[model samples]
Each structure stands twice: as C-alpha cells, then as structure tokens.
Target: MLREFLQSHLPQYLYVIGRPHLARMNYNELKIHILGLFEPTQEFDSLKIRELLSTDWTLKLTDKAVEMALLRYWRQGLLSRTRRAGRFQYALTERGFARKEWLLNNG
Candidate 1:
C-alpha cells in the first residue's frame, strides 16, 4: 500500500519540494552515457572521464560519483584499465563491446 502511494504520489511531492532529481535511470541510459565516452583506440584517464560526464549531461555529478561509477563498471568486467606513462587509463573490454551492441539492438 505504502509502496504504491510513494510510486504514484511521492515523486511529485518531492519534485515540488525542490529535491534533487532522484528518478531512477535505467540501464540503457547509463549504458549510452558511458558508451559516449568510449573511444575505440584512445585510453581515457580520470580527468577525461570526469570532463565527459560533467559536460555531456545536464545532471551534474561529483567526481567521486563518477569514480564510483567507473569502479562499478570495472568490477563488472565491462571496463579494463592500464598503466601508461605513470597514469592509469581506462577502456572498454570485449565484454563491454558486446554488451553495448546488445543494448543497442534490444532498445
């Protein structure tokens, strides 16, 4: 009962109260945002990733949030990292490529 009420009405109340947009973003939204930063050959470092996330989307997230998202993707085997020139660079793994394709097809 309470779950239904919140699902239907609480969101509007929250919005009217000037709360941060807490709408749940689905996997496709997350995937598209991440894939937009992915380069076939270029490796992304932390600064590059943060810049991409901040400028590309209207939703402004903190650096720590971006780092956490990257870490989550890394743990999911969708991202790989390497050390180059004393800095860590990130790229999508083979599994990530396949997943991206799948999401594109299904959505």
Candidate 2:
C-alpha cells in the first residue's frame, strides 16, 4: 500500500523537480546512487558524481553517457545546475530531496 502510494505521488513530486526520466530508472538503485551526492548545504559537482559512480559501481560509462544522464535528469527537473568551485554543480531539487528522504525512510 505504501509503495503504491509512493509510486504514484513521488513521481509527481519528482516531475516538478525536472526528473521525468526517473520513472525509467531502476528506482531503488538510482536512488541509492543519487543520495550519495547530497550534502546538507553544498552542491556536488557533476564530474565528481560521474567519477564516483563509475568507480564505485564499476560502470565505466563514457563521459558522454554520464553527461547525457545528467542532462536528462536536469531536463526532468530532478536536478538543478550551478557553478561551484569553478565547476558545474548538480544539486537535487526540492522534490528530488524529498524523494530521497522518502526512499530512505520507507525502503
């Protein structure tokens, strides 16, 4: 019941944040990966995320693939871009943050 509710409501929230493609991802796995990028008051760099995930997950995806994923999420409204430390940073939108909290608490 709870999972059903989340599946319905959470996507709506995330869509508002710019992550329409999130529905296509393996939600649990993607959530775990994305949560690692979060910081209380700091934005995470996109390249760092790609590198970390590539190393940790042994993904070995090309830089273009990583950039495509990032851009997709950005277009979906799940992430926002900013400049930090002379690099492009990707931060979870409010909805993305909320979804992460939900996944953590409920999963």
Candidate 3:
C-alpha cells in the first residue's frame, strides 16, 4: 500500500542518481524517516515536513504519505499533535523520541 501510494503520488525520480533505487522503507521505517523533519524536535504540518524530506533528493515522500504516517504515530501515542493555522502541527512524544533514538542506533 505504501509503495503503491508513493509510486502514485511522489515524483518519478528522486535526485536521479544514475539509477536510483527505492529506499525499501516499510511503514515503520518510513514514518521513522519522517521524523527527520522534526529533528532537534519541533512542530510541523504535513506539507512543511513533506517539503523538507523531499528536498533530501534521496527519499521520496508525498504530503498524503506524511499525513498518514503522522496520524498513525499520533494514534499510537508516539507523537503529539495540535491544530495550527488550519493544519496539524506535530512533535515527538516520549515514545517517539525513544523510538527515534533506537532507530538511529540500530538502523
């Protein structure tokens, strides 16, 4: 489902590294990767975070992908969200931070 969604919504290529390969990220990994946008930890809407992650020119992400991941995180109590400026702003909760730490060390 994630791959299908990305293939549909994301650009055809990400930075074009001769022959780029998909990151092979699963749902948990992709959501964890999304945490990059909040590094140093701050709130951000789906669009803002999507743009930031997309700019990496390596990973491909769509705003809808981000929204889905974020909502999942929120539902799992991994992140906290608040509505701001007609959009949802998100920050890592304790669980998120811990998971991020583990990901950094293990991934």
Q: Using TM-score as the measure, which candidate wins?
A: 3
Query: Residue 79 deviation, candidate 3, in Å?
Result: 1.2
| lDDT value, residue 18 of candidate 3 | 38
The local distance difference test score of model 1 is: 0.62
Q: Model 3 Cα displacement at 73 (Å)?
A: 1.1
User: Alpha carbon lDDT of residue 13, candidate 2?
Assistant: 39
Best model per lDDT: 3
- Per residue, candidate 2 scores C-alpha lDDT tens digits across 17-75 of 33323434444545545553665455778777776665432233567866777777778
RMSD of candidate 2 to the truth, in angstroms, is 9.7
Each candidate: RMSD to true structure? Answer: 9.8, 9.7, 8.1
The sequence of per-residue lDDT tens digits that candidate 3 reaches over residues 1-107 is 33333343333432233334456655455755665445546887777777766655546666777788889889988789899889888888888888776654555
Identify the runs in model 1 with alpha carbons over 4 angstroms from their true place.
1-22, 84-87
Clashing residue pairs in candidate 3 (N, C-alpha, C atoms within 3 angstroms): none
The candidate with the higher lDDT, 1 or 2, is: 1
Candidate order by TM-score, highest to lowest?
Answer: 3, 1, 2
Question: C-alpha displacement of 31 in model 1, angstroms?
Answer: 3.1
Write down the TM-score for model 3: 0.70
- Estimated TM-score per prediction? 0.67, 0.56, 0.70
